[model samples]
Target: MVTKSSSGEPSSPLSHTDVASGTTGEVVDTTTAPPAQGTAGAEVQQTPLNIAELNAPDGNAPVEINDDDDSFDGDSAIGSDVGSDTTSLTSSVLHYKYENGRTYHAFREGQYIMPNDDKEQDRLDLVHHVWRLILRGELHRAPISKTVQRVLDIGTGTGIWAMEFADEFRSTTVIANDLSPIQPTWVPPNLQFETDDAEDEWLYTQPFDYIHIRNMGASIADWPKLVTRSLENLQPGGWIEIQEHAIEMHSEDGEVPRNTVQWLSEMEGAARTFGKDMNVAKNLGGYLRDAGFEDVHVDKYKIPLGAWARDKRMKEIGRFQQAYRATGLPHII
Candidate 1:
């Protein structure tokens, strides 16, 4: 029952929720009785899809991109070794300075790009596409209830998904929490953004019906703990969706280039040195199951590092990788 968007990208099959314009935002309490559990479905759908086209404005110029560099221009490569050499990285102090006096180990150049930037928008679109795809799986299903309406969007960069979900589901209240407040204050009635870390204890009193987490490969130090927290905060029969990418280079049917593998290995090693797990995708399903989630399922998709891949599906994934690499690598490396 998944529907394809205008660009032909497949979306979750959730019944189209009404998007009412004006209403006072209210949070829902989930301590009461929960909804009935539902059966999972197994379906494979292939719809014409283009991530770039979905984000492009009518006929705007293709997104401008460049390798990580140190100009103020947005078209700079990320994760490039612009500031320090690889040899010095082990000894050099790595930290990021955000506007709100928050700092963390700055692993790559992508860390510097704020959620409001064009590059961030591009990444967000891809993330949304992948998330919708994940939600299509049999393991996750949202509970439908007018009275039980609450959503928690973890690592909600730019708050785009939160805004879209609020606009789509006017009755549901969404708390879009992130490390920064890049989201606009003026937003959909039911959507609100807050600056918070997922690792810390959350203060929300209500268990949510839907908890969505994305792209925590760099910031999250403990996958099992995080998944447990997400489960603890969910109402019985509620759904949780996690979206992430593998940092280790992987190829299907012998399409990946050797240099790409080497590059990814180096990057993975760098992240490991800094106490971050680059292969979070591998253990996500197990983490969920260990956290007491039933019917746990995992689907793996390979993304090409370059256009050298032969499979059409792999090529499309490569396009996304190239786009992110072209704009985000400097910050990550």
Candidate 2:
């Protein structure tokens, strides 16, 4: 039951089937406001669903399982342990009854849920580009792995980057955390995923060398508090990386699309109504600097959607940008 806007782009109608297919990307502006009190959002308004409670009498769980459906090559990198971990995490975080064969844990705040479609594969490819850029010294100018001992990946959806990092640096311990534990468990001995809320008080004993948070604009309610927590968790001289897109407004050469920009602005308004801030990117550097992160570097790049750009690199960026935007609809609006 998906609809389209006046612009004729498809919009995701809220429905059970839409949740299952994960193809619902409807851009609408809702009326919600930011949370008023500090640490109030962390209080569980409703109890989360427990998978163990839904298991059959025969000790079997009723899951709408997809097999041999490796649309994303990174799925192959995740072994059986990771599979079990995904199921376990879903059981802990999700709080919905599956009408028909659809499961809903795949969609949650601060979680990277890829559509079970070809678009997801393209998104994974785009992620690889970011990784390559970082590895080849095209993205981050600082020494990434030289003195990094403990690495923290915030909002690690697929855990691919963390897994790859652990595989690359065998000696470094990588802790990947997300709101929804969708990451695989069978990662390198150095890598592990924890089920915890980022906004909640952290209880980790060890400090990390490098902390990374990507695409978390929609989920995090307080940007300054999040940066403060990161700084508290990081060791002296350690680095924290924050990656996000310009959601409310974006353009090539700063020339934005009127309709697209309007839609994004409406979406941001909706997020504000829902007790979240949609403008995390603009405040990232300021938050970092305020938190005492030295040598802070910020870079912005135009990521086009569709094949609308003439530059070869821009076109490639568009392909990835489309996937990123497609998966991001739920969070924004």
Candidate RMSDs in Å, in order, are: 16.1, 15.5
Q: lDDT of candidate 1 vs native?
A: 0.49
Evaluated at residue 231, the lDDT of candidate 2 is: 75
lDDT of 2 by residue, 78-133 (tens): 12223424455445465532423423243353232223222333354455464343
What range of 10 consecutive residues in model 1 has the weakest lDDT sum?
A: 15-24
- lDDT by residue (tens digit), candidate 1, 1-333: 010112121132211110000000111011111222331222322122233322212211121122231112122122221111122223322344443333333334234233334445555555454344333322123333444389888888767677778877889999987655445666888887776667788788987777877677766777788787877777667667675665543222222334443555676787777777765766777777777776453434333333333444433433444454445543453
Best by lDDT: 2
User: Which runs of model 1 end up more than 4 angstroms from their true locations?
Assistant: 1-148, 252-259, 304-317
What do the candidate models score in CA lDDT, each in turn?
A: 0.49, 0.50
> Candidate 1 at residue 82, lDDT?
14
